[model samples]
Target: MGAFRGLAAWVVVVGVVFLVQGWLSDGALVFGDDDGLVEYESVETSELMMDAEFGHFLDRKLLQVTGSDRSNTTIRKLVVRGDRRDPTNGFKKYRDGYDVKSSHYWASVVYTGVYGFAIGVAWLLLGALITLLACFRCCCCRRKMPYAPRNRAYFWIPRILAFLLSLFAIGVIITMFIRNRQLHTQAFNIRDSIATSANDATGAVRNVTTTLTTVETLVTKYNIQGLNSGIIGSTVASLNNQSDTITNKVNTNIRTLNRLINGIEIALIVMLSITLFLVAMGMLAALMGWRTVYFLIILLGWLITALTWLLFGLFFAVNNVTTDTCQAFTEYLQAPANTTLDELLPCVDLATAASASNVVKQGVNNIVLQANNALTQIEQVSASLGRPTTLPPVCDPIGAAPDFNFTTCPNGTVLIGGVPQVVAPYVCPSNPVTTACLAQGRFVNSTQEATIKDLSIAGNDLVAIIPTVNALTNCSFVYDTFSKIVNERCPPARKALRNLWISLLLLSIALTLLTVSWIFANHRNKKPHLIHDQEYSPTGTTARVK
Candidate 1:
């Protein structure tokens, strides 16, 4: 008992050492700051909305409108200020009055690791001291005191209670293990969902860029009349930049989230495994009458039980923060505009989105109209030269402004899909058509005919990508991604975190009680004897009489 008291005193000293280290490392533990905390720089909203490909294309168009160099600043150039961490490397406070930079927050985040290390060292010292004391007492004190023969119930009762407590602790550990696995699985699902959505958006942007490059190549190679390859080239450049930015951002987010999830997973696994092993060994030692082993197990188990309580506190704080963040995210999804989330994912107003769509539609229509007008001039010139050709006009699939739907074209224009069929008979059969065939063929040469065919294919490609551009620019994709996270993923993840926290709490209680029961059982096993009748012989051998 004296040795056990010394061990407890040493543990208390080690705990104080750890407490002091934490306090010094984290500075003072002031709660709330009287002075307001520094705020992040505000991202200025622009009149022209920029999200994905549309934003890049609009940046070019804005340059054209202002008649200025492309160096003009745009809203997309502003860096996002969300996802900032506090000095403690924990999440930043999302609301007013909370000082995440305070030492109190840091302590809450890091106390488990600090104190767990301290308890580990304390346990090692305890084991060494206990072994040394046991050796000293065994070598010097040869006389054995007879343990009292109490009722058999006295022996069986503590053993029974310890056995029950050990069983309960094992049950709690198993439940915690299962809950931790569930939490890990839920975290992975959320990560996968985020990655999928971001990749989809990136792929859509890249597709649009690729198609535009095709269009630009055809226009430049063919030197098609009235079509400017330079504009297409610029739009492609902007899309490339947007694609790179999106890819880098997505990769960074995924890596960060993966690291965080993996760290938590490893911590939980290590803590639980050690705890279960200690509890099992403790039960085995107590049952087998291994005094030294039992003492060592008790020391280790005491450390583990205390560490479990500290872990519970850490997880409890984390769960609260997670719940708060989820609630804030849900609120942001409900009303995104003018919210803090806008700093992270700024969205354009409806009018700006509509304007962006109109610009794209009008650009497509103008390209189609120019192609048709150029074709008209070729036919009129051919007629003046007494060689009227039978070329059909190219159709504008995007019918009109404000609602670009694939409707029937006006008479004399061939639908984009039917252009090859109509123009097949009119394309020159060879590089040099006979005078009779020149009058029938639409092209003066094979190259001209090939160029026109290429133009038709490019036009079709351009028209196909307009809808994607519209969707990206309008921010519907952004809202849909957020909606999925908030509605489908957030609740389940939050619930899993809550359940994991509760399990940790329960395990902490069970391990603590189990440690107490071990101590009680050890005391019962070493109970003092009353020495009812005794006779000492000359050789110092004592005899007991009934």
Candidate 2:
């Protein structure tokens, strides 16, 4: 009982000190640990309309979450008074819907703290006064009298307090059990998502590197490299050698992405380990009566639950109060399927990968187009190159078999028996017949077509691929995706998280009630009875209650 009283006293003192410190300090917000949540950007309402990608993203977010049709600047757009609109109703964008007002957080803190602190002080003062009275009585009289027993009323108070304490502990344990499962689910989702992304990156890199090797072959085989016909052919040949450089750049960036994804995978694994450890600690704390461990568990519950509540509470508040702006951040929550961190990451990656990848996609597409054009040029050059219609000098016999002789005048004719006669034409025919050599046009075109086909595949698709990749791997994604996960899986459960602080408060109240009831019992049972089996040790006036 004395141990319990000392423990209770310490709890009251510590709680009061912290509450007083928080109240005294000019802290702008009690709940917000990171100011990034409340921060917003002031965009001209018209700018949203002009930037088609941002405009669409903004529109989809609003329509999906709130089903709001008021996207075209009718809602609370501010002007310069330096910002002339009503401050209370001014419009702002979260870019992601993951913020809360500082006012709400501080209000909750003060509301819960002030009342609890005052009640605690009252109990402390009363207990101190009672102790002083007992001490003085002992000093003045120099005699101690056995204290009396209590009535049924004193016995029942502790029984009721114990029942209430049991309930608070049960609620906390149940909440924690649910939360542990959720963390495990989230960790697995994160791991799987990272793996999926890693695979596509791998495929894209291998395909690009392997396929671009063909471009060098095309250059060499077409004689584009060796053609000494003109400067143009030499330039064309030089162009084909650069495939290696482009391949290197593509592979480098892809490998960087792969490393990042691997790091994410390892982090998720670590998070899973930490989550399991925390759950085990929670169980041990709940089961064991060690006050230190119990307090540690309480503090973990306090921070995690309080901060989560603050974040989501403010996020929801912003969504509710502001014009439809950033619902895409939470749209996944409203989706039909069970939302996972896996899915949200890809959604975020979609924007980034698409943006970065479009550059790649366009580059690859240009390669395909260029290759196709090269194939056309090869056919044209092959067709245009034909044998000239002229003969190399051919010296054949002028005399023919069986008395047939042929001769032609280069400028004169030979005559027989004084008769002028024209014989066969001059024996040497100079004009040439057509040559039959056709360049390997068909084979080169086939090779070019194959190269174009290789460059066509960019990678796996993303959800929001139509938008800019500005949000990929950014810190804002942590908040937004986290917000989405909470909104989707644990909206109902989050109330428990938010109210966990209150649960601790109620538990403290229950403990205080039990402690006060114990004190009352001690007051009445100051000298508890002792019984002996054989004989009451009454030979001396021990003054012990029977």
| Cα TM-score per model | 0.64, 0.36
Sequence-dependent TM-score of model 1 = 0.64
Writing each residue's lDDT as its tens digit, candidate 1 over 60-96 gives 1111112243246332111121222333444453212
* Model 2 TM-score, 2 decimals: 0.36
Worst 10 residues of 2 by lDDT: 417-426
After the best TM-score superposition of candidate 2, give how far the Cα of residue 100 lies from its true spot, in angstroms: 11
Error at 454, model 2, angstroms: 8.6
